[model samples]
Target: MDGDLRGWRQCLLSGAVFAVCMAGTTLPTPLYGLYQEKFDFSELTVTVVYAVYAVGVIGVLLLAGNASDAVGRRPVLLWGLGAATASAVCFLFATTLGWLYVGRLLSGLSAGLFTGAATAYVMELAPHGGTSRATFLATAANMGGLGCGPLLAGVLAQYADWPLYLPFAVHLALVACSAAVLLRLPETVRERRPLRTVRPQRPGLPPRVRSVFGPAAAATFVGFALFGVFTSVSPSFLAHSLDVRNHAVSGLIVALAFFASTAGQLAVGRFGLGRSLPLGCAALLGGLALLAGALWWDLLPLVVLSALVGGIGHGLAFRGSLAVVAAASEANQRAAVISALFVVAYAGISVPVIGVGLLAGPMGLEGAGLVFIACMMLLVSTAGVYLLRRPAPAAETAGQP
Candidate 1:
């Protein structure tokens, strides 16, 4: 009993650490408007800046996704925290557009490292027979932390003294505390190798995983694309279209999707993985439709609904996607396969967002959003139908090691 309690405690502590690191990644979400005003940049510049973080994340996932498995979780996480600290510092002292780009890139690197390593670390810390709960905690901490980022930054930026500087300052302090907490936690990987042995993880999947990976990756892409739009441009849309310039309101609106995603992740166990994937796709389609309505009608309530619905869809699809992929892969191939999925997911965040920014120049934000939604709706619908016809074989037994 004592051991189990200790295990749970460690797992929760690890979750807290995970939360802190991720929160830094999104701390700049609400403040992008302020940066634009100070820097005199366009919306296209904002998307490019936001997308740079995804570029960094994808680069890390491709190059060093499995680093923790080799050198141990603590070292990789500590390095991630270091990167996060650098990102915060960059933001704190950002006077030039170049600084924001660098900060986002480092922030991406921090997230890329933490995503795989921290998820694995949290699950490993749990006692036996606690995998399901651990998975929930791991994912919940991830989404919850992401949600807090915008909220924290928006609130601080609104009421605090330094709108641009203070949020990153607070995040720096949080990162330092997280580093200290991480140092006290035990390393979970027992057979650690030297850092020199770590090689870049090329994206590859077994033949059997392809069938499951396809629709799952598609859902993941659309889900993340939805998030990319919300985080990157929703604030701008709210400010320009609705004339809702309150930073706290903008941040809370953006945070809603992530919070809803956490809630959606919690429903996966009840829905079952097989059902969750298709259902998630269905929900995503509905969310996209809601977003279209929000864009077309310029309704504030519609935007809020879109965030809630879309966030739930993202959570359900992403968690279900991760579990399905994990269950289908061999133990030796699990990390690589998961990394590949994230690469695709992060690509969704970057590529499509840049596309929206480009179109935002010609078509306007609402027009560009509708076009993006139309395309995503079509893609997600196709994926949904495919899943309904042929669900992943591993879904029923997912989360079992």
Candidate 2:
């Protein structure tokens, strides 16, 4: 039985659950500086710590990405929420740097569990003819929740007591409430089987979709890589170089990028998938330039501008990638192709960030950031050229909403 959930009520409830779980993944974003001070670690260590979360996400996606499809969405989701609560507990009691890594890994597990499962759950709960709106709800929940995590933590850390402890405590309360709300919602996955039966589905790409996948994936990789740098290292830059020690302000800057991305995703429907990809690439290049300028001149304003522009570009490219790849893919093969692209994207988030950290020690943070910008600029530019030369096939986007 499909959990009998229908109408807007169920849709919103599912979205709320998505938001809460996603928020937990980023709750520690603004607090990395505090962690660094307490642990007395290098920038490289900070990036490695952050990258560990992506590792957890990738691991879960590889291992149990389809668990909900097999065991039912509600059950898998309950387990995800449990993992998230445990992550918060880890953070609440974190007395050393090792706890942070463990907490991050657990948070990644929660996100990995929720990402595909929650997306499908929200979509399934929607009424007929509501796919576009449902897509918006899920996207917003994801980006909005990510943006909120740092903002909430920054505020509490700056103004309230227990900078390290309060944020996770608050998140714990929310996760508990979200779980309660979730239990009331209907399970959307029918014909469920035992979780043991689920296997790791190998990621695949159809030959026909290859051309479009190449350029689209390139864009996603750059966007995620840029975000990785910002979230992992920008706060330290602001505090050390710009003398902007306010945690709240640092969090706000990081939050702006995500909010801007949400806005960009919304605008993609107007641009059409074919145009959005190339346009997004161009915008991304411009953003990289702005970021480079920020690093070169050490201008805080430039950094802010870069976040806004880059985030918008990221939004456009990300949504465009989703549409183009989905349109190009055979209906049956869509999930695997999308999964492959995400693997590339998450690689962007982890690998290059660690590279930046490695370079940071020898080249310095600004120099390392400049190097990152240059490399990503080349990647995005190449993608832009490819997209321009070969626009999305008409057949692919013809059916796109």
Candidate 3:
């Protein structure tokens, strides 16, 4: 009983550590406007800076996605924390565009390392028969941590001292504390191999996985793209179009989306597997419509509504996609297929963001957003159609998983 108690406690503590690392990733979301003012840059540059983080995440995912499995979770997470610290330091000393770029890149590296390693650690630390609850904890901590970052930074930047420097400073302190907690915990991976033996999992789908991976990847892609645009440029839009200047307000609006997604993920338990993806796609189409309404009517309420509906759709689609993908594969091929899905998801995040940036210059931010919404609507609609025609095999056991 005591050992099981200890196991659960450690798992929660590890979730906290995971949360902290994720918080650092979005700490800059609300501050991008201030950076633009200080550096005198365009919306395109902001997108570039934001997209660079995705690049770093994808690069690491492709190259060392499974390093923790070989060298053990603690070492990989410790390195992740180190990268997060470096990112904070870069932001602290950021006097130039170059520093912003470096900070975002390092933040991405930290997240890329933490996403898989920390999740695995949290689950592994669970006591027997605790996987279900542990999965929820791992996911909630991730989204909650992300939501907290912008809220924290926004409040501080809006009302407190040194808007730019203080947030990163606070994050650095949190990172230091997280490192202490992590170091004191025992290593979860017992039979570790040397680091040199690790190789890139090189994402691929076997023939059996292709059918399931297709629509799942598409849904995942559109969902991530929605979030990427929201985080990367929506602040600028709020200030320019809605004339909403409160940093705290902007941050909260963005945070609402993430929080909504968390709620949506919890709601997935009520859905059967086949229904979740198709219904999720339907929800996504509705979200895209809300976004279109926001743009067409020039209404802030519509934007907020879009965030809520889209976030729910994102959560539902992502969880359903994961379950379906996991169910489709033989046990041996499951992990690699999931990694390939990550690659595609990350691609959706980075690539379209750049396109939006490129369009914002000529079409204007509002115009660019409309274009993005149009493109995503088509993609999501296609995915919805695909899922309705042929649900993934895992759909039958989704809620159970």
- The numbered model that scores best in lDDT is 1
Model 1 spans > 4 angstroms off: 396-401
Candidate 3 contains a number of clashing pairs equal to 0
lDDT of 3 by residue, 1-401 (tens): 99999999999999999999999999999999999999999999999999999888988888898999999999999999999999999999998999999999999999999999999999999999999789989999888888888888889999998999999999999999999999988998989999999988777799988888888899999988988888888889888888988999889888888888888788888876657787778878888899888877889998899889988998898888988898888898888889889888888888899999999999998899999999999999998998888766677765564
Q: Which ten residues in a row have the lowest lDDT in candidate 3?
A: 392-401
Q: In candidate 2, what are the lDDT values of residues 40-77, reduced to their tens digit?
A: 99999999999998988888888889899888998888
Q: Judged by TM-score, which candidate is best?
A: 3
- TM-score for each model: 0.96, 0.96, 0.98
Q: TM-score of predicted model 2?
A: 0.96
C-alpha RMSD by candidate, in order = 1.6, 2.3, 1.2
For 1-401, candidate 1 gives per-residue lDDT tens digits of: 99999999999999999999999998999888899999999889999999999999999989888899999999999999999999999989887999999999999999999998999999999999998799889988899999999999999989989899888889889989998999999999999999999899887799989999999999999999999999999999999998989999999998999999999999887787767888899999989999999889889999999999999999899989988999999998987898789889999998899999999989999999999999999999999999888867898777333
Candidate 2: regions farther than 4 A off: 1-6, 394-401
